[model samples]
Target: MEGLRHAREELRPRRREGGPREDRHRRRTRHRQPRRPSGKRLHRLRRARGRERCGGPEVTATIAYDRPVSNFIDKLSATGHVTHKSYKKTSVTLHHNGGRLSHQGVLNVWKTRPASAHFDVDASGAVAQYVKVNEYAWAVGDTVGNQRTISIEMANETLAPAWQVSEPTWKNSARLAGWLFAKVIGERPSTGNLFYHHHWSSTACAGPHMDTLYDKVLAAAQEAYDHFKASHPVRVSNTEPFPGASFFHTGRKSPIIAAMHHRLVAKGCDLYQSHANADVWGPGDVKSYAAWQTKLGYDGAAANGTPGETSWDKLQVPNV
Candidate 1:
């Protein structure tokens, strides 16, 4: 009896009578991230733990944020607690909002639910994030998939497979996926690393609408990536920049040279003399380049049909 009384006394805090107890769960451990409102689109990249993992391919091997197509971290007021210790994000799983829900609608509903997702694309082409990229969120309703995938909830115009999202929404989602694949994953969508919610759960989650738009969305990701690469053109590796000399005169044969021909063709140059999409620098390539040069106010030797930095910049030749 004495030992029990001592234990109780020791455990009791020296607080005043009727004092209020602290509520640990209600503590303000959350803070809002700064929002930038300028462009029609929004993109944000916030790295945690000083290490950013790759998502898919479209960029370098060590994937970094290459101006995410529209990475807006429109975080919800409340997010679920992380349920796992460690996770490896291997793929992107797409889910439908199940209906035409707005961004706020999803956030408000998710605030009380025991669930969250990395991103959500609404019918307005708006992207709202409920979870951080470096942290895990309650999605997929399974262990393996949830621990190994970034979940994306795509908003639909209707539940129908034919009208999965509004044209803008579909296009924007594709652009977002492209950005994620490049920034999060290190490659484009392939047989590996892309999935529907149905792939993980028994429910027809993404529905026929997503099923019909799956491939198209993937294609848009590719197009978005290509457009990004075009604007930020990198030098073709192992290939020297055009030396301000004519390829026809030097008889240079190189794959980079062939890629140049492709760009010239795309630039509305008549490269019939050169085999369509040929890699080697041939007389046909020179003829086509000469025409492009002439169109740019060059005449005679200046229009000798050789690639120059100015012309190349405007050509938008992809780093193939």
Candidate 2:
């Protein structure tokens, strides 16, 4: 009992303000990181430590933001999470994985969970397709959203408290979403068509940083959609209306006449030698029209060089 009392007395001084042990403890902790409060700050510190241990925050791979069509790798997931039924594609749903996961990492997770997205954008912006866009992906946690939307899962450059996505990931996502919107839905991404996972579900999927940048993403998507539309114009049927017989009078210089000449030449009825399919309704135009009429099983007055509505319509003259 006496020895225990003596030991307690010796340790009591160490608990005092200016004790020897407390001084040594202070010296040891002076150069060390300060004790962080148990809240968002501490959570971030732990996340930073984990990030450093892996490969630092920044992704090293250099993938182009606007990659070619061949760059889309198909790393399709198992059929368990994908519904084979085709659905009407109406919107694009953006998401953040909430952790630093690679293209394959996201797939691995989906294997266990009953969740999957159509596409996964890695930290370097490399895209891996998991499900066909025509089919439904078991994402967005809502049946309506999953059935109508093409979900894109993006990798985070940093972990939670601020699940920040890399610049490449977001940029590539915007361009890809734009291309998809244009090709599938025939419209630019708008608030009505483009959505976040949280928009339909109970989770904050795109995170705070990406949530604020949805407007910028929509802008970028619109630009890409416009470029795509310009590059690939819609093909309309080439059925021009018949311009009537009075429109083809002699000495008349109209683009309609030039178009008719070209069609005649294409149909092996060309007799133009000196005019070279010019817009003027000269002897060449008459000869070409007479040949076209003859080729169309016309005889005598019907095969005359005068333009007729039936033969003119049969010529399939294109608009100027």
Q: Which is the leading candidate under TM-score?
A: 2
Best by the lDDT measure: 2
Reference-based lDDT, residue 96, model 2:
93
Displacement of residue 31 (Cα, Å) in model 1 is 40
Give model 2 RMSD, 1 decimal.
24.9
Candidate 2 ranges beyond 4 A from true positions: 1-79, 233-320
Question: What ranges in model 1 sit over 4 Å off?
Answer: 1-77, 81-86, 160-163, 226-320
Worst 10 residues of 1 by lDDT: 60-69
| Model 1 agreement with the true structure over 1-320: per-residue lDDT tens digits | 99999999999988655445443333443454567644434332333222345453222121233322233333342344445344656778778887777767777668777777777876545566656564567778888888888887877765655535555566666676676666566676664677878888897877776677777777877787666545564432433233333323445444556677777777788756537547656678778988888888889888887767787666655443
Candidate 2 at 220: error in angstroms? 0.7
Instruction: Return the TM-score for each candidate structure.
Output: 0.47, 0.50
